[model samples]
Target: MSDFIKRARAAEQAMRSVFPATPLQRNVLLSERYDADIWLKREDLSPVRSYKIRGAFNAMRKQDGQDLFVCASAGNHAQGVAFMCKHMGVKGVIFMPVTTPQQKIQKTRMFGGDHVEIHLTGDYFDDCLGAAQDWSAEKGGYFLSPFDDMDVIEGQASIAVEIEAELGVPDHVILPVGGGGMSAGVTTWFGDRTHCLFSEPAGGACLRAALAAGHPTTLDHVDTFVDGAAVGRIGQKPFDLLRDRHLSDVLVLSEDRICATILELLNVEGIVLEPAGALAVEAVGEVQSFIRGKTVVCVTSGGNFDFERLPEVKERAQRYSGVKKYFILRLPQRPGALKEFLGILGPDDDIARFEYMKKSARNFGSVLIGIETSKPENFVRLFAHLDDAGFTYTDITNDETLAQFVI
Candidate 1:
């Protein structure tokens, strides 16, 4: 047996004391959709609603006389470490970006209780990380990296141990990569036995960037929507292990496409997957041909979704599917101008948003309109009606800059 596999098994054994292995059952909806036997390693159903707890648990357990643990995170990793601190009776200090959602902050506090102290510093995760590391050094405490540490990687490998024990081996496994800890450990365990496809958010595909550059490269910017796996760079140790991986093994998914998957899973299968948790599941569509007749497993990484973002998620999903759109319309400044424009919409079309941007214009008014309909085909008819009516309008649905300021 390989040393990494042996250690992973040991870590899996140790993890049973903290939380049971997450579900690795077949998903009927995904199975039928892809024409393959699809299984989900439901890490989203873990104790802390993420696989992060495994790394935190194993890392804490392996340490000796480490009374204090410090980490910087604004999402699942924070809660994972906090839960471990409360469980192991160790003092923990968690640093979070000031802009982190209140829901996440509250959840972390609830999990850690009095065992952990939270300090909100800086506006971004990097800023918080720097503060946490500086505090750890100054106070003589162990600084726990979300994924960079060796112990954390070993802890994450426990997932592969559980998977092999339950299913022998899967033909293909889809993994979501952030800092590469989980990908490194899981890949190390399965090695060449299983075909592993690494999934990353297209905007923050540090792993893909690293593979292209032949080394770790910091992303210029990252879209934090998939907060669970949108890392700027992969860890050095993980890169070292995954350096030999083929470029084709990595898949970049559109952030909007992921939102559509999230809505699909929720509405179709009654599964509420957070953006990051949906990463692996979302990639299945792109690789459907490859796994059409094979046994596949997609790791649902985390389900720490904030309910308040439901509107944004829904909007994104609708926009991506083309069933919803936003447009700037020029309306003649007349009493019935709004009514005339409304006649252009199909019977199934519904206006989700309507705002008059320039009502002071004497000849015409600039109107921001958001339309939702039963099907994407409805947009074709609506646009045709607008054309026939001689209405001047601009579809700003895919205009990022304009949407950012208005949507």
Candidate 2:
């Protein structure tokens, strides 16, 4: 075996001291839907609810005489480092953005207990990361990078090692990319041996951007919905390994579609997944024809979703699938006008919300309306009816700026 493979094998064996291998379960529903032998490498089932713990523990264990380890994260990586600190009885400083969800902060504290100090340092993660690095330099402490370090990459390679042991090499391995630590390790481990598909959220598709630019590039805008994988730039080290890869190998999924996948896995399979965790499974639909009659494994990266976001997820999913919409309607300032607008709805259509706006207008009043329908095609018919009834309306469902303030 090659040296990297040997090291990965050693890493997997060492990981047993911290936690067992995450499950590699064949999902019958997904398998049947895609017409392939589909398995989920359930990293979401890990002790820290992410595969990040593997890299954290491996990197921590390899080093000697380090009493204090530090890292900056706003998600699973923070929890993983905290969990490792408690497990190893070492002290750690975990820096997070001020805007991080309370649930993540609480979980990080719970995992580390008294061994870790949580610092809410900056408004954004980059600022928090800078604070952590400066403190580490001044204090002479080990700074643990979430994905940029070689040790971390090797640690993440343990997932590939476990997959080989449990199910051998699959025909295709789908991976979700954030800063690309896990993707780098898994691809390196299975180089040229298995087909690989790299997925990223469309709003935070740093890896895809990097591949396109022939190097790591910072994005102008990123959707933080899939917070775990919404990195602005791919890590330099990880990008070096992926820069030469084919452009077609990368798949970018819309943030809304990811919500739909999250909802599907939750409602259909009774499996709760965070947005980032659903990325690989969501990509399966994009590559359905390629994987038919083949063995495929998708890494479900994390399940640290805050249930509070469920309403937003469901809303986004419905909007993306055309099952719901919002519109600004101009109604005549008369009694029968309101009833006429309401009468335009089909049987399957429900008025989810309605609010009056600009009521003082002399002839016409503006109204914000939300409608939910059973089918996407239903909207086409509903709009036709509205046109025939001489109703003036503006669909604001896809207007990001307008929908943000009103919806």
Candidate 3:
């Protein structure tokens, strides 16, 4: 074993004093569905509902006399640090974006109690991180990076140590890639013993971008839907470990599609997963052929899902599944034309939204329409009816550029 892996194993042993090992359970439902021996490394079951606590605990344990720690995160990392701060009787200062969900802020406060003080700054996480570093330097306190630090990376490698010890050796391991800390650490430990599949949210594929550039590069824009894994840039230290990796091993999943997986696990298996946590599980469908009849382990990285976002998740899932669509139709100014169009609607089709835009031509007006149906195929039938009836419309369901502005 490499020196780093050996140290990581030691760290794993030390962590048992702080918190028990996360469960690695055989998922019978997933196993039967995929025809593979599927197992879940439930990092979500951790005290902070994420694997981040491991990194925080290991790093803090090694810093013998440090009394103060600082960090910036929108959710999981912040909560993990707060929990550790309280546990270790150390003072911590946490910085988070002002737009961060209130649930996360409340949870962080609950975990840290009197040991941590949270400062909400900046509209974006990068701004908050910059502020945190400045404050740490000014206050002469230790700054705990969410991913970049070597100690944190080694701590994250503990996940691999536990998995190997619990399962012996799986044929394949799937992990969600965010800033690359967890992926780098775990992959380093496994080495060539197991095939690794790295998954990322398409909106925040920092690892993929790093692999393509041969180093870390910042993305101009990032969708923050998958808040836990939506990193705009890969961490420098973690990127060094992952720099030589093959691009083919990395898979990017659409944010909307990830919502479908979140819904699937919840409905089918009673598993509640945040968007980032579901990345590895969602990748299984993409790599089904390779995992068939093999022992496959998926690291579910977190379960910090806010129940308030459930409705939005369901909406995105339906849109991605093609069961929902939005369109702008040209309605004739004549009163009977509205009756004629309504007459062509299928029995299964339901109008979710209908609003008149404005009268463009003397004989016609624009109408925005949102339709929902039981199946994606229903849209094809509805479109045929509209075409046959001489109704002109434009489907805007898949138009990302326009949806961002209008929807």
Candidate 4:
């Protein structure tokens, strides 16, 4: 084993006291569907419902005499640090964006109890991070970065350690990349022994951007639907480890498509996963041909899903599948125009939403319509009918720019 892998193994041993190893189970549904032996490294099932706790625990344990630790996170990392603080009986200060979900904030508070202080600051993660860093420096406490530090990366390698011990060496491993700590740690441990595919949300492809530029670079914008993995910038330390990595090894997933994967796992495999947690699973369909008969392990990174978002997840999945669509229709002033337009819809189609935007003139009116159907092909049939009937309409379901304001 390489020196890094050896140290990672030692870190895994040390982490046993904090939390047991997350499960690595063969997913029968995925195995049969993909015609490959598929396994999931269930990091989502960890103590804090994420692999984050491993890094936090390892980093805190190595601190020489630092009584106070600080970090900023909107979700998983906050809970991880809070759990570690309570476990270590040390004081911790956690900063989160003011817009963070109430469920995550409550979970962090529950984990830390009296051992940690929670500060809701700023509107964005960067702002909270800045505040955390300034406070850490002012108080002379160690700032525990969520993914940027070497010790944190080393600690995350424990996932690879457990994977190896549980299942030997898999032919290929798929990991979700955010700021790169988990990917860096796992890939560094496997080295040349296993083929590795790194997946990231298309909206937050920081690793892909880094690989293209040959260094860490910031994304112009990030889609935070996959909150856990939506990092705007890749960490320098982790990017250094990933610099020479082949571009083909990095895969980017659409945030909407990831929702489909999350729904699939929940419905088909009875596994519940957050959007970031489903990244590796989403790549399986894209890389199916590459792993034909070989065993593949997908690291399901976290499962800290808020049930309040389930409706949104289903909506996204339906939109991506083309089973749900929004349209704007221009209705003639004639009284029977509404009836004629409704008649054009297919038998299976149902109006999910309809609202009229009145016009001052009596000659024409605009209506916003939402349609849902059992099959995506139903939309094509409905569109054909509408075209033949001469109904003026625009489909805005897949139009990101237009959907922003209307949908």
Give the C-alpha lDDT of model 1: 0.89
Runs in model 4 deviating more than 4 A are none
Sequence-dependent TM-score of model 4: 0.97
lDDT of 4 by residue, 350-400 (tens): 999898877636788888999999999998899898988888888888889
* Tens-digit lDDT track of model 2 for 10-118: 9999989878999999999999998999999999999999989988988999878889999998778999999989988999998988877787899999999999998
- Per-residue lDDT value at 341 in model 4: 87
Local distance difference test, each candidate:
0.89, 0.91, 0.91, 0.90
Full-model lDDT, candidate 3: 0.91
Worst 10 residues of 3 by lDDT: 398-407
Q: 75, model 2: CA deviation in Å?
A: 1.4
Give each model a TM-score.
Answer: 0.97, 0.98, 0.97, 0.97
> Which residue pairs clash in candidate 1?
none
lDDT of 2 at 166: 87
Candidate 3: pairs in clash: none
* Candidate 1 residue-wise lDDT at 272: 77
